[model samples]
Target: MTKPTLIFLILFSLNFASISALSQKPKALVLPIRQDVGTNLLVADIYGRTPLKPVGFVVDLTTRHLWVNCETNYKSSTLTQPKCKSAQCQKAGTKYCHTCPIAARPFCHANTCGYYLENPVTHQNTVGELAEDVIAFSSTNGFNPGPLVQIRDFLFTCSPSALVELKLPKGVQGVAGLAHAPIAVQNVLASKLGLKPIFTMCIPSGNSNGVIFFGSDGPYSLLPGLDFSKTLKYTPLTISPFDEYYINVKGIKINQKPVPGLNISLLSVKDTGSGGGTTINTLLPYTILEGSIFKAITSFFAQQLSKVPTVKPIAPFGLCYESKYFSSTLLGPGVPSIDLELEGKDAVWSIFGLNSMVEAHPGVLCLAFVNGGNEYRAKVNIGVYQIKDVPLKFDLSKSVLGFGGPLSGARTHCENFNFTTVA
Candidate 1:
């Protein structure tokens, strides 16, 4: 080869190698969440807090900031309290500077930003110093995890252990806030990495790990290379002033028939923000509906399944029946499907038997729903149990919710996601 030809070949080889490396870099951050059956809480694996310790955090959808227990021998070289006037403090919406009456420690620092962190499980509030630390997550190509990506100064509150003493699941140290707040881990990661503010969650119903992806839609590639994104149905997502997610659900249906006596006006939000509406909540285990809505739904459901022998009602469950009477389908129990009539043409979120009914006891199946009482603000509160096994994408940038309705329609489930580490 001539000198010029050899030089051209060398440059081409270098460029090709660089492109190959870039292509292999993960396009999204992935977090594996395990379902704690006893507590009905979804716990996510997080590696952080100086020296990088692996900790489990309950996934809280309504929490504004990530709060962790730092009162017990918490030591991190990268932990630093933000000044009251710092940008970090402003982002957290706290203005008061904290004062420590006792000795200053990690969360009890003086002249630092004071933030009120809530225990998602107990709903108890405590004041803690707003601080930053190094948090890391595994990067993924939307299929398998690649390597660890670090966020050098992730913002969180160093809370006391009292908030979690008896409330949270065992081995879980903190709450990972995935709400629509600016300081939420998902948004911070997206902003820092220059990616779109979007996230997708597929909660597993079984013992296996579920998957959550930040910044990409899919090639979700559960076993058999199925992409749940293809089945997604789009609907406008409304974020309340309180940072809760609400959908434009106009009505409800059972077995393709609309429930009678459902006050259409009761399904809407009022001007005072205290009237009836539907909102999604991960903290809640079962779907809760207003008293009237609940009565109408259960009455109609029981009527539809008249062939099944009724049994004495369970304490929490209003209706119960012999489980043997019901047949099994790939979707779930062979029961009537419930549909949420949303805004737009043909936008209905169908909830199959798996998402609608729960086996409260052996040989006994009950509707996995609760009456929110007449005073409940939201007419419909969609909980995590009803959302599991469905691929849900929250596009904060576009204010849209893309729901890949029940995967059973495609003969797959959320637990099918491969968790094996990629080399």
Candidate 2:
């Protein structure tokens, strides 16, 4: 017999796929995220109906599958994986296991259907069985009493093990997948909530809390009047082979002069598996530049510090100088500006320097661009830190991505949701 969880998954998917309710005026929800331990992750409550203590999940755009910490940690006791020989198991038989390259999954020794996920950057693995349950985001920035949005019969995995070296008690437990795939929590919730297939992320800066807004340009957004989406720079949004977002880079300019090093082939298959691999990820802790581009920027930094005494390099960071001796503004107000090639001149998304400098220690600021390895799959990322105080709008209806410039001074984070302010 089919497991009840698998049955619910099949029924729930079938019900929503052909629903008669047409896409109405888009509804929007803005949920604030947590910046735990330098990683910009969305920490939200799971399973609103259950009385279980809340656990936090990382809302990473590169994660392709929804999963929880452990089976015992799972709030819903009824959550179960389809047994071997079941249709869900049969489906798993066709898909490749990245970890066990020799065989496909449901290579079950135990009767449970299972899979393992491996993250390339952190080299961590989350192993578990597929299951179903409900997921909910708390209303007020994960601090208040009630759930803002709750969806029942949600399909996800229950993982009991993870090889996490950086795990902390006030840190990530599970990953909330947001890749543009069937299993992505963002896509699933967008469909169920009657919202647009779009969202926006803003970090503002190093001090403030960030928020993710769903349906940025639809009827739900305050674009024309109160919102800053209208004023953001624009570019033609492209998709990777693996269903992640990509943007075109026409060229990079250093102090208004074109830097020829950025013009190179950066083609790489991103989001190749169930884990993080997107080229430009908001949640990625560091910004990565293609090798040649990284060299160009560091060399520019070197010339600026030629007069200063020898500065020791920080591990992982190729360039670092004591900020007390050197001006924190060595890269200056406008050093490296990336010119993104959009269809028209008006749509270009120019880059800035405030996003590139990293403060590693007391009175120390380093150019934070990591050298993306020589592999064809390596990607250049505009991480959450690089886009500080800027708003990135993913407008599905227009198939365009908007990137706003930094706000004047340190802008305070926006609070409260206004459902009545329909556009």
C-alpha TM-scores of all predictions: 0.91, 0.71
Residue range 335-385, candidate 1, lDDT tens digits: 999999987666799999999888888889999999888755678898998
**Cα lDDT tens digits for candidate 2, 1-423:** 113223323333343333233233325555544455544544443433243234566667666667666533445554455665666545434242224334523322345656655443464775566555555543222122122444565666665444323542244567766666665665666666766677777653543335567643632122123356556666666666566776655445554555555434442323433322225675566677656667876676566556655467775678876666644342233334544444445665555556666667876766667776554244467666666566677765566677776543223232222322211
Candidate 2 whole-model C-alpha lDDT, 0 to 1: 0.52
Residues forming the 10-long window of minimal summed lDDT in candidate 2: 138-147
Off by over 4 Å in 1: 1-26, 103-106
Task: Kindly give the stretch of ten consecutive residues in candidate 1 with the minimal lDDT sum.
Answer: 1-10
> What TM-score would candidate 1 get against the native?
0.91
Query: Per-residue lDDT for 243 in model 1?
Result: 81
